[model samples]
Target: MIKPADFDFHFKPDSHWQWVETIALPFAVPEANINGIVYLVTRPMLGVCMCDVTLYDKITDLWEDQLYVDNQQHLPCPKSLTEFSLPNGLSFKVIEPLKHYRMKYEGIDETSFDLEFFGLHEPYDCNDPNMDPLAAARNGPAWDSSWSGHYEQTYRIKGELVARGKRYKVDCVETGDRSWGSRPERDNASIIWWHAAFGENLAVHFFTKHDIAKTNEFGELVSGYILEDGKVYGITSARGSQEYRKSIPIGGQLEVTDIRGKTFEFTYSTTNCAYWAPYPAVTYLQSAMRVNHNGRIGYGIQQLVLSRAYLGRNREALLARY
Candidate 1:
């Protein structure tokens, strides 16, 4: 396992309170591309709507005490949740919401007529630093690791199955809880989840969000395995793992898959994550990701490689180096 220090582990300004500014996609194509600035900021974890996860709250987790316990951290009751998504293929999407978000997917074939209701909370104020501004956006029903978050997106498009989603309805129970505990305990034990329903597979990816550092940078570690068709097994990348393959324009190419560190082929390009600057000199990291599972070669694996400097600074970088 690689340590955080391996990545240089330093922010641009290295301040507590940070801000995120977005630049709209100007060029044409499909979907709306938005550029975002992820500064070291702390804000409320509020957003679209609140959720009701009384189901898990009633249960018991060993780390309940260590969870965020301020007034805003706990909202006694859960409320109706708001669904955030890019209805028109990829029009507008939810980015770095204060707290985490959830998504649910439903469809029959690979592509054609399907729906995904993704939701999140409003981000906290960008000016504040004394507290976590990003997490201030959360609403009713305290956000707990036991409940974790949710996700809903199409696995396949035309009848082929995306490696992660084949046929399943993933859930998050222990994840949200374990997310509040220590790393060893959290990573060692997790009830992660992933759900999908497609032509050749029914897959899911689940894991616990362990704490990254006591500095409060992040109290979650994300890991899980992508189980497709009950035969293919792809373990997820641990938390704080960001792989920058190649630079593109705004809403560029993004490689999203499980199977880590393996030799495979990539026939598709990223459309959402590569953001372009006015002069093409700089670009932001677009959250949009689209990788075709049946892109000529069918599927691929992750190839980890390092470099002295690629994205400007000097350090080790991970890319789809196939």
Candidate 2:
């Protein structure tokens, strides 16, 4: 369980040790042929924040508009992570520890939003001792370097967004994650993080250790949980792989079973995607996806991070094929 103290910054003597909180919200505007995502990452130790918002129109199959500010550095550090406003027009307040939060952003561009997140269940701790041994071991150094103290929760996000003279109502179910540990900028590792929700009662969040060079591989399921019928269950086993086209993820399928032996299967395809380089070597791709589970339509997001070293090593082959 996450304590109240966890909502505040956890700074250490080592400069590399840092705290991070991020929210990814996916929303749709009915009959507008538009779908979008709002993503924000805050790093108190570095005194910086990253804000990304993009709207994509299915009719054109292109990014209609975006407000992306990846480097907001050297700003004054907030005293507490739970409740504080940054100079860059970003503000966060916690209504309940590990359960609810309010986030707002007024960027220089025409994009801005005020959103509230309500947790569907208890936060899932990545460091839980009850995790499967094989999955825990597979996490290895990647977990040690950055994900040592990490927890993720699925939230029902509701708010409003205004962009380019248009207002859209936002109501969706997504995932938010927080972590504090030694995070180096240039680690040579790659991972796939994804979230899918069937409704208010069913949601899934997980991570897979991936090798960028192998485009057809499913990689290894390292950590995750399932929220079903108002209860949370640690994932016991999963079989899934992301489908890629020319090194870019287009869609994937997953069959995940929790500790209770209940299984859920779903597949997703991308509607829109945007790229960002948060760190020198960390190239990230965030996409809004349309999910289909048990023939029910739903919404979700897929985030993948690849290190520059992986690209540098496979540059020739990637260039030839892609």
Best by lDDT: 2
RMSD of 1: 18.7
Q: Write the per-residue lDDT of candidate 2 for residues 1-322, one digit (tens) a residue.
A: 5676776666664656355555455555434535555555666667776655556553221233333332454556666778878776778899998788888878666767788889887777777665433335554532655665677788888888776557777777777777766666665577888887877888888788777575556677778788888888887777777666666678888888888888989888877665655445677666667888999987777777877887888788777665
**CA lDDT of 75 in candidate 1?**
26
RMSD of each: 18.7, 3.2
Off-target runs (Cα >4 Å) in candidate 1 are: 1-224, 230-246, 249-267, 272-284, 287-322
TM-score of each: 0.25, 0.86
| Residue 156 C-alpha lDDT in model 1 | 22
Where's the lowest-lDDT run of ten residues in candidate 1? 174-183
lDDT (tens digit, per residue) of candidate 1 on 77-138 = 11211223222122122222323332322222231112122211121111122222222344
